[model samples]
Target: MSELLQFVFSGITVGAVYALVALGFTIIFNASGVVNFAQGEFVMLGGMITVFAHAAGLPLPLAALIAIVVTAAVGVALNRLAIEPARGAPVVSLIIITIGASIFIRGASQLIFDKQIHSFPAFSGDDPIHVLGATILMQSLWVIGGALAVFAGLWLFFTKTLLGRAVLATSNNRMAAQLVGINTKFVMTLSFALSAAIGAFGGVLVTPITLTAYDVGLALALKGFAAAMLGGMGNPKGALVGGLLLGLLEALTAGYLSSQYKDAAAFVIILAVLFFMPQGLFGRKSTDRV
Candidate 1:
């Protein structure tokens, strides 16, 4: 039982990170109808920027804030410089653009930050809290709490705020949203910025636990994509559920089976979602009639 609880704890911590990444994916996909593969780079930027800033004598909180803001600006720039110019292009082309952007960002980061793994001190101390005989890091609690708080914030934003409704309307139908005087372009830009900010925040929160490097974004992007697919793309609720579920599966596999196969769980989940549950847990089936 203790072993099982340990696995669960590990899974939830990792899952919270994946959940943040997945939410980023969801926001971009919903707003632009294009997946931003560079999403994970935002996470990398968050951690890397904070690490350097903190090292440069800035407080951790301020450093994190700067990272999030800078990442959001980068996201806005991505939209303006790349996505906007190719707005009417084929979806495949947009996806390829995002992939290229990811590679470009990764290379830039490697050059700027050097090829070294880095981490920051945990927000709390290094102490572990024991719950039901399973020890968990205090930072793990922060991560879980962060995920829930973000989820709640997003839920309220979508369900209550006027800007949120505009974003939703744009996501529902871009042409109609524009006709209704909703600034679809602004909505897309906002989506990217918000997504990037969220990803960066996750990176800041999780970096102490998971040391980061420039190349880490690729794996994170892949896993996040898997989680998004599992929960149903475009559904925030689905993103959260899928991320946690994927994390749990990975932890259990690593614990009971072999750590070697744990990463493969994301690939398997993606395949399973594609073949059987393509719509995902909270996603609705769609049909078009000619």
Candidate 2:
């Protein structure tokens, strides 16, 4: 039971990071109808930039703040330079574009930040807190708290704010939104910025635990994409549940089964879930009215 609790604790911590990644995916997908393969690059940029900044004598908090802002700007640039130009392209084209962008970012990061794995001090101390015979790190609490706060904040933004509604309107129908005087182009830009910011924040929070390098983004991106799919694409709530569930399952598998195949175990469960319910756990079915 103590061992089981330990796995659960670890799962929730990693799951929070996955949830953040899934949230990024859902935001971009809702806005542009395109899955951003480069979302993980934003995470990489966040951690890498913070590491560099902090190394250069800036405070850690300041470094993290700058990283989020810079990543957001990069996201905007990506939209303007790449996505906007190919506005009417096929989904395959967009996917290729994002993948290309991801590669570009990774290569750029390698040049800019080198290939070293880097981490910073935790927000609090490195001491572990005990819970029912299980130990949890202070940094893990920060990760989970960050995830919940982001979810809550986004929920409020979407439900209570005008600009948020405009974004939603644009997501529902870009043409109609434009007709209704919503700046859908701006909406798209905002979506990318917000998504990138979220991804960066996740990186900042988890770097202390996971340690990050230029090459870490690809695996994170894949896992995040999987979480989004498992939770029902384009749904924030689904992303949260899917991410946490994936983490828990992976931890359990690693604990009871084989650590080497833990990721494989998680994928198997995702495939099984998808097989029975194509729409995913929280996804709604849509049908056109005749």
Q: What is the C-alpha RMSD of each candidate to the true structure, in Å?
A: 0.8, 1.2
lDDT of 2 by residue, 1-290 (tens): 98999999999999999999999999999999989999889888999999999999999999999999999999999999999999999999999999999999999999988998899999999999999999999999999999999999999999999999999999888999999999999999999999999999999999999999999888888888888888998899999998998889889989999999988855786688678886778998877869
Which candidate ranks first by lDDT, i.e. highest?
Answer: 1
Q: Quantify all predictions' global Cα lDDT against the true fold.
A: 0.94, 0.93
Which 10 residues in a row give candidate 1 its minimum summed lDDT?
A: 280-289
lDDT of 1 at 81: 95
TM-score of 1: 0.98
What's model 2's overall lDDT?
A: 0.93
Worst 10 residues of 2 by lDDT: 265-274
Per-residue lDDT of 25 in model 1? 98
TM-score of each: 0.98, 0.97
Q: For model 1, name the residue pairs that clash.
A: none
Best by the TM-score measure:
1
Residue 182 CA displacement from its true place in model 2, Å:
0.3
